[model samples]
Target chain A: MFRGIVFAFLGGACITLQGVANSRISHDIGTWQAATVTQLTGFIMALMIYLFVRDGDLGGFRKVKPLYLAGGAFGSVIIFSEVTAIQTIGVTFTISALLIAQLLVTFLIDRFGWFGTTKSKMGAPQFIGLAMMIGGVLIMKL
Target chain B: MLIGLLLAAFAGMMVALQTIFNNRTDVHMGSWATTTWVLFMGFVASLACSLIFEGSRTFNLQQMQPWYWFSGLIGVGVVICLVLGIKILGPTFSVSVTLTAQLGFALLFDSLGWLGLEKVAFDWKQLAGVVVIVAGIYVFKFGGKKKSAEAVQSASAAN
Candidate 1:
């Protein structure tokens, strides 16, 4: 848990900013169009960095599964669904549902060691801690 | 409303799965390359959807700020850090911490009204929520591990 805490926090902050930015962009053009622009710009930026770094073994590509290579497609649906949900159910409910679902999926993934992740054993303390976190999220909405 | 909630939840699931899957790709492709590949895939998907559903509306860039168009660059930072964190801490713990950090930013954003997001009045309830979440993480990290942690450390040392 402690490992890569900085990276984790930074990732979260960046997501928030990106969400706000996406919303603003969508307002200007259109939702899916905004998504297209986002992905395009993101790809370009990442490609630039990759070329500059000149790292990672090309041979290791064989080690990665084909299905995982398409992971980025999820972003399109994520953008589309989340925006529609917010419009239909409102921001508060959308945010709450999003957080809960995310936590639930991640928790299940950890407990089952799904998709090749390390299995995490949960005891009473872990459960209690998780409950508290959920409570905190709900409270934030309230 | 139920459908809306379901859609929201499904989006959440995608968010989680996307990170995990992207991390797996990162293991082989390296950080920047993995990010590039993921974004490229996303671009293809979004473009397809745009053409099919969004169609004519998709191309109308009618005099919007060019700066806002660059927002996607921020995704570069988000993906790289998330993959790095997941590599070290595993998905669940890493994501939980990420959520906490996000809320912290939310608080800051709300207080300052940054990026034109509505300025939410600072309230004790929101403050308490932050406190509780932090406490939860503290418990998850170090609670009930005093003697057992020491014992494990010693056991490992002896091995």
Candidate 2:
């Protein structure tokens, strides 16, 4: 549990770092080019790790649902929207708004068991937690 | 204006959905392979989109600084960390913690003017916001501990 929190923190830091790097690259190149380049580099790095680990079978890829394979496509949309939103609304607002939106969708997803996820009903505490987080984000932007 | 905000919200939804998909894929393929597939597929999708929308103008590779290339490498860290996090922390907890970290680091980055971003002076409001967010996470974690634990157990049992 402690380790999970630490990993989650690190993951968040990586996202911020990636966002900065992406913005810099996008300024020099076009947004799409930057995204494509970033994806390519990430692919190469992951491929290298895969080669070293040699854990999962190539055959497993064929067994998974096609919808699962569309994550990358959604990633593309995320990049495009994130970059554009930041430019339009500033980083603080964009991040805050994104968080709120994310929590809302995540709540619905969990409640409904959408997208192969298990249904977990949200109680008052969950809602309060989400609201507090969103409030924090808004305050931070102010 | 509102449309842009709506788009941003949609993008956030996409992010949540993407994580779900990636997590599911990770169960089958392992983290490294899953990351590889995601990046490769994203690269293909972005490339096609770039070609269609930007056309020949999209290829400006020579103008970019060498350091800019590190974004992709950092992306590897993001994928691996997220997969590990979700596996352990579950999606909501992982994502909430991640957002807190992202906001904190983003504020720091802005203050330092790192990575081509213009410097923004640090404000107490932001600090307060960070505190509130951390508090919220604490509440979320402890308040719903039993429920989340049960959910996690059930999820693993399902698998």
Query: For the second chain of model 2, what is the TM-score against the true structure's chain B?
Result: 0.74
Query: Which candidate has the highest TM-score of all?
Result: 2
Tens-place lDDT per residue, model 1, A52-141, is 887775456688998877777888989878767655654444555676676557657766777877766656775677688678756866
Per-model RMSD to reference: 6.8, 4.0
For B1-159, candidate 1 gives per-residue lDDT tens digits of 889889989988887777677667767777667667777888899999999997776787884687866888788777677767867876555655776776677566666756655566777777787778767765654545333221111100000
User: For every model in order, what is the iRMS?
Assistant: 6.0, 3.6
Task: DockQ for candidate 1, please give it.
Answer: 0.52
Clashing residue pairs, backbone N/CA/C < 3 A, model 2 = none
Off by over 4 Å in 2: A1-7, A140-142, B1-7, B83-97, B145-159
Give the best candidate by lDDT: 2
Q: Which candidate is the best by DockQ?
A: 2
Candidate 1 CAPRI grade:
medium
Model 1 chain A lowest lDDT segment of ten = A86-95
| Clash list (residue pairs), candidate 1 | none
lDDT of 2 by residue, B58-107 (tens): 78578978766667888877766766787898766776677788778877
CA lDDT of B73 in candidate 1?
75
